[model samples]
Target chain A: MNKWTKLDNAAIVFPSLAKAKNSTIYRVSAVLKETVLPVRLQQALDITVKRYPMMTMRIHKGLFWRYMEYDDEPLRVKREDDYPCHPLQDRMTMEALLKVFYYQRRISVEVFHAITDGSGAMEFLKTLVYEYLRLLGKAVEPEDKIRTASEDIHPEELEDSFHRYYTPGRPPKIRNTKAYQITGTYFEPYGNNVTQGVVSASALRQIAKKQGATLTEFLLALLMYTIYRQSSQDRKDQRPIKVSVPVNLRQMFPSKTLRNFFAVALFEISSQQEQSLFKILCAIKEQSVKNYSKKVLQEAIVRNINLEKIKIARFIPLPIKDIIVKNRYFLYNDKLRTCTMTNLGRVDLPKTMTPYVDRMEVVFYPTANNPLNCGLCTVNDNMTISFSRTIRENRIIGEYFRYLSQEYGLEVKIYSNEWGISD
Target chain B: MNGGFQINHCIHCQVTVEASLQECPLCGKKLTNTRLSVPRSYPAYALHNKSSYYFQLFWKTLVPLMFIGAFLIPSLITLLTGEGDLWLNRETLGIASAWVLVRYTFLSRMHMGKKFLLQIMNISLALFIFDHVGEARGWSVNYVIPFMLICSTLAMMYIVYKRKRLWSDYAVYVMTLIFLGFLPSFLYLIRVTSLLWPSAAAAGFAIVSLIAVYFFLDKNFRSYFNRRLHF
Candidate 1:
């Protein structure tokens, strides 16, 4: 509550790179069985903001760096308007870096990346929905998964976990990475087109088990294969379809901070067209296992902290640092990834809350360079795979959904925000 | 598919579309079954209406139009008309004034109090520049800036009073405007201006506004300074 705090290590990179075209905003939503009541939702949000005071902080530029300060204005719960992942700028960031919106049956929380990562945002969404359900007179308990309003705020929740766990001078376990970037005609009004596919979580897990892999490894291979199938025969082996997967570090190292504490693990599949998806899944599992050694994560934490700790980098004015970051982003940020996919794995709610909730979705905003990004989460028995893109052509999406249906015989129920299509 | 939900089967895409959508979001193929439908998972959003479409077009052309409309068109007309007064002409001043005001007022996303102070300063600057170089080179500071400062202070005081909860956040800006209101007095005392009454009125108004705020909202101003220092 004392005025301001520094941006987390991973969060430092996003503010400099964010713009209208390359928004670093990501969304996590829950669709309840009943229609959303705005009044009750607003009340829930007001309570939630008090419980999580960090959500009310706004980022401001200092002479040396950007930092977050407590913004005391009351938070407004907006009725859903505009397309998803429109840039959060100026007034939006000035008010608060996080926003909560509601549609027909959907209550969504869109977060600026400078504030929190996917895991942290998911925690906020779950707590918000829990409070909403309670306000509606439901008998839902926190059940240890949700952050309850009655519980005392712990100091550990505010610690910058990345800085806490960074190990200095550890050499990175690196690899030669070059990925194929998806390109298509840009949408006239720049916005994210979200296409989500809902399937049975148990069925997805069973199928992954049949292929001798975890759900993430299985989906990572399938995504690569889908993109590979769409390419011409001449371009099939031209480049590896690499997916940048974010792994939550709380599982490995013990930390309860609701901030960015995750690392990226790159999984690739190349020249595996002749093999079945099962073989590709096995190969991806192997590659992913090798890439995710603790050394790799330690190096990521160290490197990120080191970049900001450079003596000269700190003294240089923030505007000049932003220019340097922007120039570097245009040259290299998305040059090595086909797309980004962050899976929340499994979302568990209190037993009493399950009947009211239908599904949960995590939709990441696609950057201009990396035109396609995927996010998915499983709650109860339903798994939703959401692909958000900034392009006109959605052939990859159609093919991915179709492939999941025809190959695994997984019943795919598809829906979208329909940003671009006229009809 | 298991919930007896009215769903669309897209044969081409080979996926079952939710009942909310009339066509496949991926393939654009119409729903195979056209019948009475259940509630959709999402609202049927008007993706782009006429106003929004025009706005999109305007947004796309805004940058190029800012350069051409603000700079090129007026300069071109002046060149063709043989009125080559690039910096000091009436037409040029009018266009520049419009451009600065429009950009700062309409486009800036700063906090409302900050933006208001900046806009008033911008207008005062333009007026000062115009007055100093013109045949009449004294009115801006002597009358215009002092009056503008007094008005700005009153406006900010009103905002602070109306939005009591926001007083803590906006009080600093009001204080800033009060500090700026002394500039004309400084100018007059330094003999940069001949008239002292206008400067005196402006500073007198500013001090009176501050006294009123302090006298009435003593606790509020105290807490304002308490929260003023940032970590």
Candidate 2:
């Protein structure tokens, strides 16, 4: 018999809204210096799977709720033949929520959001690369952060940290107001077109410091400014241009759980106000400094957990709960913000393994309504900013990178998934 | 126990081993006694037991209790009212059959063909019981069930046609539908049902569908059959 566990608080919304267009899946890939050997990769994955027990489970249906059970099926590593962030067909596959695919020197791990968040997925990817390097006869010593296959999986890694950190209090509700939305023609065959911009980490940091804002604040301001400039003018209704930024709670709270322990911070700027770049950056910096504070994030966490703790919500059956959750998510996506921007922050690896690995990138899938999303991660001073969009128009992505090169005087190497839109 | 060293290290990987071991787990390097004591880099923590008792209780105890109560409560109410008849018994059985149907549809982790077959059987059984208990009318065996079987077979065929690449995956399901399509004629022949048109219509449609696919879509049909039958 296999073991089973209840779905975590953050994961409860993903299973209901999972579809082709809105897969809620993300990818983190590591580019190695040598070509990937499939046999060695499979061997490494077999060993690594034992270390991450939570990643080996499958979602199961229960009487009042959906739970996850350990799936004993063998996981297979495949070649990358499909588009990035394709929906995980658990029923068709081995019932695993995450998949490993390799192409040339790159090894990618795509995980359904129901399993884990970006930070947790990155941990898995890092450990996988560690194991892969070891299998390849590379002298990869285990580091402080990397959990090797020989070590026992920690209890904290499997815990639902949200439940542990949730405090019962009357926290002010986050507003759900409509923001300026981007409209465009969707790509054919319903695929995500990823445009990755690789820039120098020190140079980007210098620019951020010069603007008197952090990298995240600077990027948020640029994203909002780009949207504000591109959005069509509707004289009757003027809404604020907003971007949803996911904050990793592990930094604020003392928890090492691999499950989702993150909160989203919505940053908005008035579209009607004619503001310069400096004014926008100042506004973003002020709001972000206040929002990213511990007190504000704790309030956000309390407000989110309070929804799950409602008396009526606890007793409601799974089917009804799914409907309620889906409706809440739909409303959140439609009215809460224009788009999402998630920063995985700097990823550090063991010194011994650095020679074998090149760099890393993170790609987030877009929702049906919000057709574009941005994910950023820095590895070995190579900051890769990935834009994943389902829309045909790449003007925003083009302009964003162009702004970095032309205005900011920073060299940005740009590439794309090349979805081949004839238009 | 040499006085020169208190630590064991792998000669190949050059990493210190925390536990007593004969070989290095990472590179199969033989352990050797070393003079320097190196601290273990990994944390000392027991692996968390993955078993969840709450999930076990919900699935093993609560779900079965709910399944039983769905039938038991209604029957108990019917009996306690002192207005019991064959109707209550039939209703209880119908509810139980409906529960089985729903359980197989949503809960059972069976293949698509097995689920479809189970659904067909459950629906037919429920209709048979209802027809027998209500008025002994042959409408269930006569028109309803045969029509349902033929319509479902057509739907499955249409689905297979639409998903041409997955025709092999649905071949067994289509074959099962064809086998079920012949079942209504058996009922008619056994004198359990008096209606001949419905059975003939269902069987005829199944035969025609089989012939059409085999003749018109010969290449796909042969490929699907060969792959599904493992020939």
> Which model scores highest in lDDT?
1
Candidate of highest TM-score: 1
Winning model by DockQ = 1
Restricting to chain A, the TM-score for each candidate equals 0.96, 0.96
Which stretches of candidate 2 lie above 4 Å from their native place? A90-94, A232-237, A420-423, B1-231
Candidate 2 lDDT, A1-423, residue by residue in tens = 325567788887888888877898899988777778999999999998888888877765443556676666777898876668887654522357989988767789999888899998998999999999888898889878698888887788888888888788897765567887777898655677776766788889999998788888888788888777776355554778889899999999988888888998888888898966688898888888788999998887787778777887666777787887778777666556788999998888888987777678899899977898999988777788889999877667766776777787675654444443311
Over the stretch A11-124, how does candidate 1's per-residue lDDT look in tens digits? 887888888888888999998888889999999998898878987787765556777767878888888766677677575435568989998789999889888889889999
Q: How much DockQ does model 1 earn?
A: 0.33
What is the per-residue lDDT of model 1 for residues B84-128, given as tens digits with 9 covering 90 to 100?
675535555556666667666675566788878888888887887
Docking class of 1: acceptable
Q: Write candidate 2's Cα lDDT for B1-231 as tens digits.
A: 111112454443333333333443333345565232332211121112112234445665787688678767767877788665646677677767876776677755666666887888888888898888778899999999899988888888887788664454466678778878888899989999898999999889889877877886798677444433220
Name the lDDT value of residue A360 in candidate 1: 91
The 10-residue segment with the lowest total lDDT in model 1 chain B: B222-231
The residue pairs in collision within model 1 are: none
For all predictions, the C-alpha RMSD in Å is 4.3, 20.3
Clashes of 2: 0
C-alpha lDDT of all candidate models, in order: 0.80, 0.75
